[model samples]
Target chain A: MVEVEMNGTTPSVRDELITEIELSFGLLHKAAANFDNRYISRVFRDLGPLRRKLAKNGDALATVIDRLYPHNSASRAYLLEVTGKTDESMDEETKSAVKPEVDLYIHLLVQVYLLDNNRLEELNKFNDKVIYLLGSYNRRSLDFIQAKIWFYISRTKELIDDLHSIRPALLSALRSATLRHDTETAASTITLLLRNYLLCHEVNQAMNLVEKTEFPENAGSSLVARYYYYLARINAIQLDYSSANEYVIAATRKAPQTQLAVGFLQAATKLSIIIELLMGDIPELQLFRKQSDSLEPYFMLTKAVRLGDLKLFEEVLKKYEQAFKKDDNFTLVSRLRQNVIKTGIRIISLSYSKISLKDICIKLLLDSEELAEYIVAKAIRDGVIEASINHEHGYMKSKELLDVYSTKLPQDDFDQRIKFCLSLHNDSVKSMRYPSADNRSDINKHNLAAKEDEMDLLKAIEEGDLDDFMD
Target chain B: MSLQKLTAELYQLYDQEEYEKCQKILTPIKLELIKHNLLLPTVANSDSKDKINDLKIAERILEIGALSSLLSNNYRGFENYVAQLRPFYSNKQIHAKPEKNTDQTKIISLYLLYLLSQGLVSKFHVELELIYNSKQYNVEQDQYLLFPVNLEKHLMEGNYIKIWKVLKNDTNLPCKEYGHFLDTLVNALRFEIAKSLEQTYETIPISNCKGLLYFPQEQSDATFESIIKDDLKMTGWTFKDGSITFKNDDDSHKGNVNPNSINLISNVLSYAERIESIV
Candidate 1:
């Protein structure tokens, strides 16, 4: 290490340099406190002094801090300070002067935090600095470095109520760190934030951010897929299916390459189609189904549960069982199979009006209470089961059949097809004009009522069930 | 030697009705404005046309090699100065007028007039200058509140006498049907302004070619007259005599140019004379 000499013509020069260094550090601190209004701070402090000193002496302040403070808290803080994470200081000249030292400090702090997983308090203490560095750093390589730290700090195992505090700080961290010019950095930051926003159920905020974001045109298929996924899911929740398909198709354009990515994209694409069906945009259902069928059985199984599609729920479960049987290792596949079976049971419970919880439990071979209640709760929360009755029992009364979700038809070209389907079912009653049966045929007499119920459900599925609900 | 001498020379040229000469003498001084990126072309439709004619006069002056006599600075030197000022010009930005109309429209109109005079002034200061980069400022900030009669509030006025005088006494359409024509004009102007501002990102032309308005493909004299009957109040006189006159509130003022003022008419006339001499 090169030793910095203190006796350069004694106290006068040292004192002036020290005063300048102290002033520069003070400005940096003030900037961190009010980074949003950086322009005002620069005007107040007059960035000329720091910039001139930085030009005159390269990292002389860091050297002085080392000579004076050594390895104390103030020294570590000074080291962290050396990183110059926040570039909100008014002088662009000063920023360019001390950028290397700041970059080194940032990389060092990030490495230290990542290595020592026990540094929770240390990470929390310098959380703003980490965010500042992340935002200020120009390198695209640092994307995951900052994100991993954030993910570790915030997503420690499961979410807690206090986790909400980290969310805004994390958002600010990205805001301050991400530059408008760097496409890769901007796209990654947007994707991470969008995922967090979707998980946090702040759909409106996520959508707003996505709308404002300018992503790279040449970003990998995965990024585009995620972009559409976030949009479709939000619009799915908002019940705006036509708008959702616009994004889903955008996602599909980036598909057909990565099967791993296509799994999620296919699921979202199918979900968008189902949403369109629910919103009464039934024409695109065939196209969506073709995409969903190409995905693996397990992928389709989860979607069926989320969509509450009874027919898809059954078909995918059947496919899952066949795949499981062929493997012959029932022990390994048993848990996966059980999850699919639960999803199927939930779908039936959600799709039909008359289907009881008892029937669902028996069909799934699940205990009447725990597994059945879990399915019902998940269905209700996902909006598969709309709350219907005002019964004293909250959960039971809240449950709704799939028919309850058929909202007012879209007033567009899509509405014409829906009208046609409705007409095919309701407008003209089929009449078989024949001589009165001499002794009413036993087949018709035995149970036309049972046949009608089956026929009605089948017809409903054929008319609107064209949705790619499984995936 | 003194700022007053320069103003007097300009005044003399204006008084002689030598407007082109006045404009030429003002050209070197206008370089100061262009140096500060402040020589905005006149925004009035009529004045922009006048600018083209003035430019032709400048070209003719150059061909005669009289420009050097008129301008203290050489043409190459002025060009160099303009080049040096380009970066500063590009960096300049002005704020959007706030949606909330806290600014007084009369004050804004006066400010606009002051800006025009500053552009015309021989010696202008950069620090004191307030630039208007937006075209919408004239319509939204000036026309609504500063104009003698606002279209929106015309019908709602409690001063029935003033309203009736503006209508029946005015030499436009009959005052009874004033509402129909004026309302249409007000709505059309509002939409045109809003549309222009919404469309353009750069400094918008506040006024387009006057020819677009005055000389249409088809002759519609009645339509044109009805549209600007109020504005014509300031510029014209009895149509039969073809004499230019202005409405004077008091008998104290004698002429359209205010002859009683110490230097007002002389100053205007000198500027006019200088402009004519340049041509």
Candidate 2:
């Protein structure tokens, strides 16, 4: 293959080039089959030069090669495919066994080009072609391809801020992946769908999907991490900070160390810190040093939250404003200022249990004592501090700290964990599907055992009543 | 359709402000170029002499696409086209004549303005740095590009009056698209002024505000008042005795706080205690 002459002086060289192109096409097909993005991109990159070399030869055999590869043809149909204007006539198959594979490769190439050029119209055309092709074939067998196409479609729509319009395609992708039992695609499609819902602020819909969708048990770690990350975001939005923190922690732990997964981990860590701070607990000191250096801003942000330094927090926000915005964490970061102030007041309450309102105003850098009074009253009401404000004397009085052993808080925490476990079990049961007939018998057996147990309890109760009358 | 005819139709639609129609016409032409292997050249492999004309045509199409996207306020689209044009422009192969490069400057200016209007200060600086670092971008030869650069500097220094003066005195704003972005920039400036006033002053004469904001002489007081009262949501201004007294109200305080900052601390605390007690 490497011996092919670039000048294409002879027939043998041309044949060699054609064979090489065919081999690359075969590799591309395998890559696509395995959903290997890196391998697919590499094959496409390698084919570009070979196709150009064949085009330059300008021989009868070159024309044959062109017919197969079609490097550059002015035909409208060819143009449509290359520019991602899909749904054009697919009548010109090159009588090759790998025709469909070639078609898929060409469509993907054009889609990437159009996407790079921000050509939304052409991208939409490509999406239409994918949808049309899926409908024309056995969709269950084409689940991988369908999932890949939907991923690109959803991504393009998201780039153009048309995420709201991607519901139908995403739903179909999810359904196909689920039906085919393709765990990776199902996990990915679910994540994409959940993200769209979160972006649109449809928290209820996102939660309902989380409850209903049965993620395959063999999902990849990264996909599972994404699931937890999105669940964390949803819970955070719904003000369930404890559950949100748990999910974020799970996500950060399970997230792989790939470049993309690192970003997810960073985001999860950021949210986890915010949630922990909001819960009046400081994130562990080691968390800041554990991640890569790119997460340094988050570490500084954590410090600002811990120290209750409003000025430093604002500075950090302004310095990394673009980064935060890119991560979609700007709103969350902006909301941390209130937490900073609260934390400042908490520190002040601990230091000076009977601080005057004027002193509190100075300590928190509040503009007026009235604002300080309002804040202190709010803190007391919210239970951030075990203290009461004396409106007449303009001072806050802190109560004595209770012993940890005397508190029922630990018992309540156990109950809450149990409740969460029960809910998880119920959700799993609801989402479980008996796709094959063999699984139905297992469910029936379980149902029968439950019924027998209920009958036994009833008989015991009836016998106890008769025994009581005899006595 | 012939590429020439399609290109002509695209310019016509663009001139008439029919951007969507222009895009529709350009798509097929772009596809044709791609099919003919002329849209982008592998410069390392291809001899420049053999494909100069094709490269020129490709460059022209990218320029038109960039302009159309700018006019339509599609920054991402504009960036895509500009990325395609960068190698050509940076190589000094296209637009060899400085005098004939006004369109390039206009596009660059519009891009700068776009960054400024979006409040992307870091990105704006990055773009300007790229231009300064490039060998082809001579400040003296490309003076037309200085408008956005100067405006950005004034914006950074909080010199709104200087920005107003630059916009008012400069007659050479590159193109009509500059006007649209300038309007957005002026709105951002007005917001800054409103915020500063809310922080510093209790009231100012409406006449002084007109001067401070550099409202055009032709614009009526009623227009300015509506912008202030309706668009700015500043109410309870006493427009009497040849002056307007801005009332100190919660609305003014609302301006003092960053409106985007959500109050999650209280909500979090409410749940935090319950969870803590249970834990």
Candidate 3:
């Protein structure tokens, strides 16, 4: 694959690229004329092949541009200028209009082409011009294209390490996306903005952004997953571990189960593990045995945490400090020092009904029996263990473990299950779509002779769905 | 008054340690800034050298507002001023040379300490994320910044002893402004310990309890008792025989809520009625 990409700028490859982009242009036109975004999604579906082709020979982008745009057109001039010197600038002397969708699509391709070629400075300048173009084009069909373009624009700035320079543009873009009720663009920009803030370690600003903005309910799932992942990160950093755990789990569940999304899955998994440890629940050993070498550090760290070994925890931390820092989990992992002690106290409390604070202190390698007592007290208060410390006697005693079925926990669990099932039922019913006029013309007109009953059903659903369900 | 006169006067007042007077003079100057469209650094006003210099003046004014408010014990006002200065610090105009700003660090650390002293741990971590990761702020090297950073670390580690030692050594404090948070922070620290002590001990000599909470032994027992009951809200605690007894809340509340038989019968009857309807 590397060799093929490095083969670089062959004529056949350029021709192949032109054909591919022109075919995608056809898809873009279909999307526009039909007002259907699936064709556009199909166009993106072709992006992987185009990415490979563009990496092989990016010069084809200019040729594709020349053939697509008219001579002396403003967009043509702008695109060619920013694309840098190409092999040739061939243009037809026709005064034809290009669709805005096509224009944004090609601009997105140019961004991908520039980034693939590693022409970051050129890409950065080009993206600035593209941002202006995006602002001018108010076509609703251009929403997805504009969102993807902003992504590449932000990616360019990210590559050039000029994050601050792009903030004003992204903020304004987010405002416009929200203003127009463009859910895709708004969701994309929110994720991009969150990524930018997280990269800068600006958790306060990110949290402020989250508090100020509401994520659109109908956002694409991948973008929602990314948003959830970032939220989990922010919450984890703020020490809201339970909510962080919720978000990370949702992120992993909603993430695309494809090989391409393996990186996201791995990161979310690593975070979930650390969050679980911080919350004083050991992650399962099965998670560590998932057969990835990158998780080796986490695997060892989880081991140390699960065993409740403060010495082992410190060793693991010191050994994997660099890796943890690179993953932005160092501070969170450092917080696990306290959790480790709590877990140690918990284990000791479980084993021995009554133990001296001195013994607990020696086992946890704590500074003194006083520290151990205080730590144990905090653990009890935090619900880590069902135990108490007798300061006067200098001994800790564990309360008798209750029978699980005797408590109200089972009732709460059953209530949660029922609620979940009810929600799932409601969501399935809501998502049940009626046939559009086009889709049902054949089936309803020919196959379904029961047209009257179908109409009654449709009317019931459209007007009285709630009344039917409520009774 | 012009910005120059107001600024100079404000600086003189600050130098004289007349923080209250400085705050009184800050209002009109901030309005003047708004009038000139210089209150917040906008994108248009940040690039050029001349505009950058004007933003610097605005930055200086807000920094003074922050410090003076902090000194005068106007904590909310100080928070607002620091919030207003954040854009300037991040605007890439002032202190863009990657050089350290002593004033910036000192003010930020003060805000951080304020957050810590108030026990806003989440907000404290949020601010710390930026400081620890930003290349511009060397948190470990700057004593002013390091103070709050260390305090937060020890707080998270549940290492209360180190925090007590750090808070007690007044000489270790980097600046006079840091001295302001010490009382509240020490009080907050003791509050943490008092709660822990309540849970950790079923019975303990009052002297040991006082030591655990960092209360001076010379302090009277009545004062300690009142402080615990009033400030810490450990109402279940009993003080007698020169010893403290912690009342386990769970034990007292364990059998308090017997089943409400009326509600239970009503629920069962409703279920039976639904079943009859189904049948």
Per prediction, the TM-score for chain B is: 0.20, 0.72, 0.88
Q: Which ten residues in a row have the lowest lDDT in candidate 3 chain A?
A: A462-471
The better candidate by DockQ, 1 or 3, is 3
lDDT of each: 0.40, 0.63, 0.79
Fnat: each model in turn? 0.00, 0.00, 0.49
lDDT of 1 by residue, B30-134 (tens): 554345333442233114545544433322322222222213323344334333332222221222333223222322332222222223221111111111222
Tally clashes: model 1: 30
Q: What is the lDDT for B96 in model 3?
A: 70
Local distance difference test, candidate 1? 0.40
- By DockQ, is 1 or 2 better? 2
Model 3 lDDT at residue B175:
85
Candidate 2 at A126: error in angstroms?
A: 2.8
Q: What is the lDDT of candidate 3?
A: 0.79
Which sections of candidate 1 miss by over 4 Å?
A: A1-128, A132-163, A170-180, A211-222, A252-471, B1-279
Total backbone clashes of model 2? 4
Positional deviation of residue B168's Cα in model 1 after best superposition, in angstroms: 64
Q: Which rank order by lDDT, best down to worst?
A: 3, 2, 1
Candidate 2, residues A1-471, lDDT tens digits: the string is 112332446777666765765665665565557544334334533543544454433232323334564423323344344332343334565444434545554444445445545677767766776666555544232343344555567778877777766798778767876777766568778988988876655565787899999877655455677788888877665556789889898887676544434555667778887778767688887887887486787778888988888899999999998877566565456556767777887888888868888998787777667556555655654557767555456677786676644444454565567666656665566655333585456557777864564444344322221100000
